[model samples]
Target chain A: MTKKLNVAVVGATGAVGSKMMEKLVERNFPIETIKFLASARSAGKTIEFNGTQYKIEEATPESFEGVDVALFSAGGSVSEVLAPEAAKRGAIVIDNTSHFRMDPEVPLVVPEVNRHVLKTIPKGIIANPNCSTIQMVAALQPIREKFGLTKIIVSTYQAVSGSGIAAIEELREQSAQWEAGKNVEANVLPVKSDVKHYPIARNVIPQIDKFTDNGFTYEEMKMINETKKIMEAPGMKVAATCVRVPVVSGHSESVYIEVEQETTVQEIFEVLKAAPGITLQDDITQQLYPMPIFAENEEATFVGRIRQDLDNKKGFHLWIVSDNLLKGAALNSIQIAEALLEDNIL
Target chain B: MTKKLNVAVVGATGAVGSKMMEKLVERNFPIETIKFLASARSAGKTIEFNGTQYKIEEATPESFEGVDVALFSAGGSVSEVLAPEAAKRGAIVIDNTSHFRMDPEVPLVVPEVNRHVLKTIPKGIIANPNCSTIQMVAALQPIREKFGLTKIIVSTYQAVSGSGIAAIEELREQSAQWEAGKNVEANVLPVKSDVKHYPIARNVIPQIDKFTDNGFTYEEMKMINETKKIMEAPGMKVAATCVRVPVVSGHSESVYIEVEQETTVQEIFEVLKAAPGITLQDDITQQLYPMPIFAENEEATFVGRIRQDLDNKKGFHLWIVSDNLLKGAALNSIQIAEALLEDNIL
Candidate 1:
């Protein structure tokens, strides 16, 4: 029998962190023991996992003392401070935050696309890609491999849940008020702590995260930079427009790709259909493409509406949907852990 | 003073048809007399316009007897048969339906972008571009005029009313049912007549119209082909993924363009803000943006979230939204009527 690993999930009370623990248990990660750690504010809270009640502990340098693997899904600041500490304590850290994503030392991994990158997981810590990038790379890798991508134009219809729990709560409350015909209040516009708020109940907000100096949001530029990094295609052209829709969980994207060689939509469809971790749902005659409600709770990245451009056959368009919190974050990190265990690295 | 022209708005009971009548009255199109025509089922209905009620007439060859300008918003089959009948009577027909849109002789025009094309209206038919394509060309015109455009990649979150009155009914009933936690059925998906149905309330549907043999939906290919025709850039590269969202009115697009000249986000923003018929609402710091809710009843196309790709400064991204029935179909047709009157062509 394979040896079980002692795993610890940091930021155990947050949305993605909570999902990470659930996934670890759902996938049966062979956890010999589990530690739940969060900030002091969430300390002393009891979380029930597999009928066992474990009180959340305040995360610190000593938090990873006996942990064999550490999963960090807290905010970037928390991961910035405590992830390295966990790594220093000899725990193989699978970080779901952006703190070490761009760090050359940390290997960013998406198992379906770049599972081989796990071989370079220097000493202890590894990085999980941004939620949007993970699903996109998963969908594009096979096509990129076969057709050899030259450029990508992506426009995302992201859910409000990507921002965190407060954004999700705000969406739910505002939608309820809008339904009642009441003038819903606004406290979460642009960003939560920003000066103003707008009604997002029935609207699409084009801005996601703060705009960087180059005009793309930190979210959008992340997709471009990370796709280049993960796919090892730095010269491959990629541009993204990330917009927040009223969706609760799954993130949908309309992706246009240009390949170096001629590729038909039928050929591209076959490639994606045969690829791993992808479900091809592109029957336009029956309107059976991907939707967030249908993608919720699923682990795989869903691709549909695959079509070739009328003007250019080498160009292809696809509609992609995946549960952002799952494939985009928690489930992927868990997949990485499973990979680690499979390779006897844990 | 320009001579007023007699105008008729056909298919007055439908969404775009209703908007046509409203726009004709709104724009004060130098109308000497107004006629409303529809199918026999809606022929006797009376619609109120500018404090006067006009009885709807059954659309037939004889309906265009003295009408100098005819706006057709009926379905493709209806327009296919009746449009020629009306056109044969010497009335200038501006069709909002897809029947004559791509016809070799018909001049498909977006007045703000390509009014010159109307002079070549053979088949006596002037075609209005698709709802998604109309707003895109309007925003792209200024950029295309100042800096030549080489490629356009657009993904639309189009409203359901673009389908017809039945779709509007479905969205209303489904949303009401969804809010009350009743069983919400999807009678339209992939396409309405298809065997299966999927819930669109609180969901994003990737397919808009029926898919063609090439796997691209008829709607997506329309945007691609129509962009070339309206922009007068036959060789311009264009691709689109048209998705139907639960939005009741406006259609939003995440558009990426590669311009011929060097352009920055600020330069593009300033150009769009200065352009007529375009409202720029992109202040990211305040979280202010062009959303479907704000663009609902607005005549002008609202564009926001303008940004530049960090890797390619020549590449720019934008979020565009506009009322589908108004600027996309009805307002454009009415504007053409006004232009016809202004030029004494009507």
Candidate 2:
């Protein structure tokens, strides 16, 4: 007999959290009960799901008393304090924050790339990989297995929505002001509290987050370290340069990878076409390729522009694009929940 | 004593040619007479320069009879048919087209990097490199000479203005339509005459020119081949992925280079700071870096985000930005003329 589960969503009012709620309803998961949890500011608000009004509750530890599953998209601190509480209350927590992503006990899971991690949740919490790291690894998984991947060099053209809802509002208002021949003001982008803000309308800002001591931005380091951890390829060489573009939702990457053995473009296309969660769009005759605007609202990652390197026979280049808000954050979390259900782990 | 010369600009009404006129007048070049030449469609149009209105003349083989120097930015087809004719009429032609860029008889020149090539023009024509390649090599020349560069991999975020004035108009109109809740009409991007066209508003297009046999677009090939010729490094491994962004003017690059010797970020910064036609904007503490919006009207190539590779000691990364119209096109042509004059070749 099939069992119905009670699910709760933390940070129910954020850019990613709202998408999580929509995806849960759209996918029509086997839910017997649904609870919307948020901070105190949004606790009294009401949202509609399944044609019923559900009042948002403040995410206190007591909120997870009877919840069977909890999906969290709150900030790192909120997850740090609440995720373990939810887990201790017998609810399996899928945390979408960087706080527990690198923790040795907490498993960082991307169901398409690594689904086995969901079966053994010793800490009762699973961490979702960063937005940029999620799509890249999903696109690389098939090739990594077939060709024995050795190294990756990626340059990302990320969207502003990755920063949160305020950043998206800033991009809209700033570009509109520029178009109207008025002065532009920017309060959230590149880094929110970094003491300097740059207008991102029709511009590409190279610094996505605060810089680390080694000169790589924190966002770039997230891609480097998170990719290694998720792929279980700690010895693999990975380098990233993350830049924020004026895009609204989708994130695109120009990925150059070297395999352990030489491979042809045809082999790569076939492998990725059959791979799960990836759509092949590399036909040159019809001028079909992946673009961010088209990737928005899409659940699958789009891969195109596959070509071998001019000088390096073992190297190949690809363009990967996906909805950063969907597969990158919201849909990925819900997919993890579905994986747990399919494996009968919960 | 300085010699005054008669200068003729073909395609005077075009985007780059108009900038050429502005640069020539702004710099107060030693000119006895200035002639504006365009196609028969715009022959009699009058333009003001140096507080004087000069009527544009129809460009023909006889147009260069009394001209000492000719600057060509009119398409590649126009240069293929008329550049040699202009040279035969006692004019030193600085051709800003890919038509003659790879010809053995023609020397591809970037004034800041390889100005010495202007000393001898066997075909009486000096070729200008592609816009994206121009800024990248200018930022790399000083480091390449100091460290002996051997490999380059670049991903470009180029502007729509590089396509022409018509492409710029398309971008503006399409973006306005998109903002007004109408479907975007794309007719001039990624390749105008190609079977399909992608919108360039709030999106990025991977293809810039027609695809070649090896699966690389013609623009990507231009960057790969022209970088070698201009740098005189025929053996250097160059790879490029050209993507057009929604920018109006400046072009930005995420460049990864491998040098022969091991180096540090500080040393590379010192060398670039002292190099001509390069501006260093790397200060991580204050979140300072080069952006396309800031580099739009600038002449110098802005470089920043310098860091050594984590695993490869000889590999380094940089972000390069510059105005595609100035340093990439008009200013480079005028600088080539200056080199020819200074070397007594004109």
Candidate 3:
């Protein structure tokens, strides 16, 4: 008989947090018991798991007393305050926030790419890569390993869902207004409360996160920095344009890359065809490619529209799409936890 | 008194063509007479301009006779065949297609930047710059004149309307399906009449036009090539990513540029503020930006979200949004005609 683990999920009512819980149950993890936690306002709420009712608790250090794993996804500020508290209670923390991703002490883990780094997981908290970077690295790691990557240029068409539940509501409300010929008031999407709201129903807002002093948005810069951290290739050149689209759930990226080794489109196609946790749907002759609707509830990253760069023979262009909430955040975090159990580290 | 010029709008039924007529009327173009032309399918239709209705005529060589200006937006192939016929009939053709933009004898015109080149509109044919490029150059010309540009990297969030009427219809119908909880049936967009259709309701399709042998979409290459011609800096380094979003009208671009001279965000802002046919709406604190909805009926190219690039002191990043049908195509063409009339060259 296998020993079942006790798991705690903080921010269980939020978008990614709820998805995390769903994926946990979907993956059939050996959970002897589970605890759902949220803010003070949501503490009294009850959610069902495994055909039983579970009350949502207010997350605190005391909440993780005997828990073997704790998942955090409230927000950066919330994680900043509670993550350390949760870790202090002897539970291993899988943080899904930017609070500790770049921290030297916290290991940023994407189970497929850097599971080995788990042995060096410093202390008790482990960082999950950003939603965008996780999906990108997941799709690229196999290619990177087989072909040896040199440069990456990616333009993202991100869904509003990546922002939050508020963004989804904003999109729905504004879209309804737009159809009614009423002025759609926008307060979300493009960026949380851009100084002036712009309609995202039928438009792509180029600015994702606020621009950092260096001109890249915190979101764009995260992809650049996180990709380096996740791929463990600090010297690799990565340029990204993160644009928020009307998408509700998935993120689609048009990625152009140059690799060191000689490779053809067909050869690269063959490699992605067999890549783990990746689906290759590139059949241009039949007008088939990875799409968000099909990728909606799937955990695997979808890669399609693979071709070699026209001018640079060493370069390649590939379209990568994934459910930002799933593979991007929730699913990836859950996978890391599974990896922990697999290695008997939890 | 100013001499009125005879004008003809080829492809008058189109998104861009309709705007050209409206722009012509709004600007009070000195037109002795206006001729609306389209393909045989739409030849007999009528469109209202300035509260007056005009009948659409079938385009032919005879249609350009006695016409001082001919604005062509039917498409590249249409212009390829009809533009020369119009030019041969002594009409100064301002083609909005890629058909003649790069021809040795055809001058690519963006009046704000390269109006001086109009003096040498040889072969009686002038090529209007690509819509995305037209607005970008409108904004950049002032900066380049003040600071001298060296390098440019742009990623475009292009509107579906750029593809034509069918795409707008597809977006509407597909969105209706998604909202109603039905499977979206896509028959257009992501390129019309392509073998397979994917839902653009909440997805971003990276391929804007058919891919050229060199990997870049034809749309991207046009932005690059046209920017060079209009700026008269054939050596200017420009890379572009042209993506089709769910947008119905406005094309937004994330532009990163480096200039040769020392400059700051304030300097760039000041220069653009004074530039012709350009409106600066960048107030990050107020969340004011150049969005498609507000830009719907406007003629000016709207530039906003301007900031200095962090990595390079000489580089600047901006969000450039404009109605692709207006500033990008029709309005720019009309402006060129207006410039011609103002110069007494008509």
Name the top lDDT candidate: 2
Instruction: Give the Cα-based TM-score of candidate 2 against the true structure.
Output: 0.99
Give one digit per residue, the lDDT tens place, for model 1 in B1-346.
Answer: 2577778888887888878777766776677888988899888889887789989888889999888888888788888998898889999898998888888799888878878776767788898889999999999999888888998888888888888878877876776787678998878654676566677667787777777777777898899898888887889988888888776789999988889999777788778878979998888766667888878878999988777765576777888999998999898888877766666566
Q: In model 3, which regions exceed 4 Å deviation?
A: A143-153, A190-196, A209-215, A233-240, A256-271, A281-284, A305-317, B145-150, B258-266, B306-316
Error of 3 at B344 (Å): 3.3
TM-score of chain A of 2: 0.98
- How does residue B341 of candidate 1 score in lDDT? 62
Query: Ten-residue segment with the worst summed lDDT in candidate 2 chain A?
Result: A1-10
**Candidate 3 C-alpha lDDT tens digits along B39-109:** 88888888787788888889888888898888888988889888889888888888888888888898888
Please report how far candidate 2 places residue B332 from its true position, in Å: 0.6
* TM-score (chain B only), all candidates: 0.96, 0.98, 0.95
Ranking by DockQ: 2, 1, 3
Q: How many backbone overlaps does candidate 3 show?
A: 6
For residues A63-163, write the lDDT of model 3, one tens digit per residue: 88888888999988888888888778878899998989998788998887889989876668999988888888888888889889987767788888899
Q: Write the per-residue lDDT of candidate 2 for residues A227-253, one digit (tens) a residue.
A: 999999899999999999888889999
Which prediction has more favorable DockQ, 1 or 2? 2
Task: List the candidate 2 regions with Cα displacement exceeding 4 Å.
Answer: none
Of 1 and 3, the candidate ranking higher by DockQ: 1
Give lDDT tens digits, candidate 1, residues A121-197: 77478999999999999999999899899888898888877878888878777767876788877677547755667
- Overlapping backbone residue pairs in candidate 1 total 1
Instruction: Give candidate 1's TM-score.
Output: 0.94
Worst-scoring 10-residue span by lDDT in model 2 chain B: B111-120
